[model samples]
Target: MTYKAVFFDIDGTLVNEEKEIPQDTIEAIAQLKESGIDVFIATGRAPYYFQHYAKPLGIDSFVSFNGSYVVYKGKVVHEHPIPEKTLELLESTALANNHPIVMQGAEAGYANYPTTRSIRSLPNRSMICVLRCPATEAATGRRRRCTKRCCIAKLTRNRCTRRPKLRSVT
Candidate 1:
């Protein structure tokens, strides 16, 4: 059996702790493309976070935001944004538990509450910029297409702060 396409994640799987692709991996990707296999990026990161890696890695198709958005050859083929009602539920849940969350739209993103050290340290370690916006801004904003909801679970004030844990509403 043969596969027609291959997908790669951006963070640890594709880039190292230094956030740089290894030379061997780059060569492998080149070989895969040269052999007629279609390569694509599948990442939970917002597209802009990994924008610089695209052309250098020779990838045009992507399934970003944990499959909420999909693009092929620079054209968006699919988009499944979370609804506003769900965002409300998530926001309330995170607030009650004192957990922080970062909601990301196609063009912009921000933290729902005041950030902790861990949250603030994330962007510096990588390219994921956590924009500082007013909390009144909706997670599923009507003005922008919301594609990613990243729940950040951390220990706050010696208590384990859980986040907006997802549950299937069957």
Candidate 2:
């Protein structure tokens, strides 16, 4: 309770399993600030994801992507992305085995998979990108909590065309 800085995990600690960050959590962070304590976030979420989420709570420092990157007050303190050679090997293995893959780049990402793949495949790529961005970015966003069931539900619920039933001629 008297710690100088507190590092809260994004998933299941600050945010729900569905990646929903409750308003109460934000209030708790405010209380910490009022107590003169520095609050930080540590999560597997990418920096960009963590930023959006942590910003709401007024958090500035973060250990994101499982510590691959570190950010302090909106400035990048450190970064550690996977090597290009390793990325190539992983992509090759995935392609050879016909498994889905996502390559996280410095400024962009590449997702590779069969078009006939299932909904479960898309998020794997997004998670990879999340690991590359700052932690704050990963803890937030539509892609952060996208799962197979959630994706399917969204697809079903959000219909582009709402057409009325048509009568058939005899």
Report the number of the highest-lDDT candidate. Answer: 1
Quality of model 2 by C-alpha lDDT: 0.53
Model 1, 1-170: lDDT tens per residue?
78789999887877888989999889989998998999999987667567778778869898888877888988889887666578667666766786766666543344545445634554433312222221213443433322233232232343223333322110
**Model 2 over residues 53-106: C-alpha lDDT tens digits?**
776778888877677777777687888766545554664576579666644332
- Alpha carbon lDDT at 151, candidate 1: 33
Clashes of each: 0, 18
Sliding window of 10 residues with minimal summed lDDT for model 1: 127-136
Off by over 4 Å in 1: 88-101, 112-170
